[model samples]
Target: MHTPAPTAPAHARPRAVHWLTTAAATAAVIAGAALLQPAAATASPDTAAAAQARPAPDAQAATYPLECRGGAPRVVNRATGDLDGDGHLETVAVVRCDAGIGTPPSGVYVLTSPHRVVATLLDPGDGENVTEIAVAEGAVAATLLGYSSDAVARCCPDRMQKVKWQWRNGKFTRSATPDARGV
Candidate 1:
């Protein structure tokens, strides 16, 4: 005759099973704690310091190109034309400066050669803002918006003057009459 093997009650498991469950729970808790840590906490000291020293995207130090530092040269407007009449297109960049408070200084840079600044057409604080800039037919025109007189508020522009610079004799000159429609 055949005989059946003995078995434990359903409510009670083997001692080995209890130890296995406890080990799994402990591992899960450790994994959760590891995942909860901040990324900076895992970074090296040098990496953390570099991240802190980095400038904000909009900061003046970040805005200006490596070559130009004067006036903090934040390029607000740009145009391309044969500004020097060399049959090659030159760049005209209107930049704003970070000078103290109020309206920062502004200027225009003429790039006769590629990536090389040849001359500064306008200086900062000469006007409130460079409303528009364009180069056409060997002439560069800039619309300067600013107070007509000291009596007017610095924030308000009582006049809009159109200035023209013509490329001649290896340099640019201010023209008395500005082109009405600057290209």
Candidate 2:
């Protein structure tokens, strides 16, 4: 006679299946906890490694070249002084102011050569505007003040380039007044 294979009972089989399902659920929870961690909540092992991989915020550029379009540069005036603090004015920095007249555009620049900018500064303020620029002795002095335009005024002019370079006793200062009339 051939023997028959034994079979598991339905009731106990279901209980055993329940324990297996519980173990699988627990494993899933542990796996999810491992993956759901907040990165910045604690200083984990790789803090130094992270710092090495990022750039410092305070880093600056070492050198920059100067180039611009729409305006050419020239030295309109020159003075004698030690502007660069090297005891001589051989290193000349040029400055210029461009303005708008009805249909023309305006801008300003400080130049160290025919094509170099030692420093570029904004040329407008609360009660003043730079209209003319010249370099002397190594220093850049610009004419500034309120000026009258046909669009802004009518009678008595009431405007002029109010300041000039006062190179006194090897030192320079800006003097201002009024009456800067322009188009």
List lDDT for all candidates, in order.
Answer: 0.66, 0.42
What are the per-residue Cα lDDT tens digits for candidate 1 across 1-183? 878887778757658888899999999999999999767756445633543453212222222332344545567877767666444666777777655566654677776433666677787647657878887776888787766578887776777678888888888887645433322
What digit string (tens of lDDT, one per residue) describes model 2 on residues 1-183? Answer: 988988788766767779999999999999999999778766554644543443322101212232324643323232223344443232222323222332122223333322343433333222344456555544455654344544654223344564444445644454554654443
Point out where model 1 deviates above 4 Å: 1-71, 98-102, 178-183
- TM-score per candidate, chains pooled: 0.53, 0.29
Quality of model 1 by C-alpha lDDT: 0.66
Poorest lDDT segment (10 consecutive residues) of candidate 1: 55-64
Q: Give the Cα-based TM-score of candidate 2 against the true structure.
A: 0.29
What is the lDDT for 128 in model 2? Answer: 41
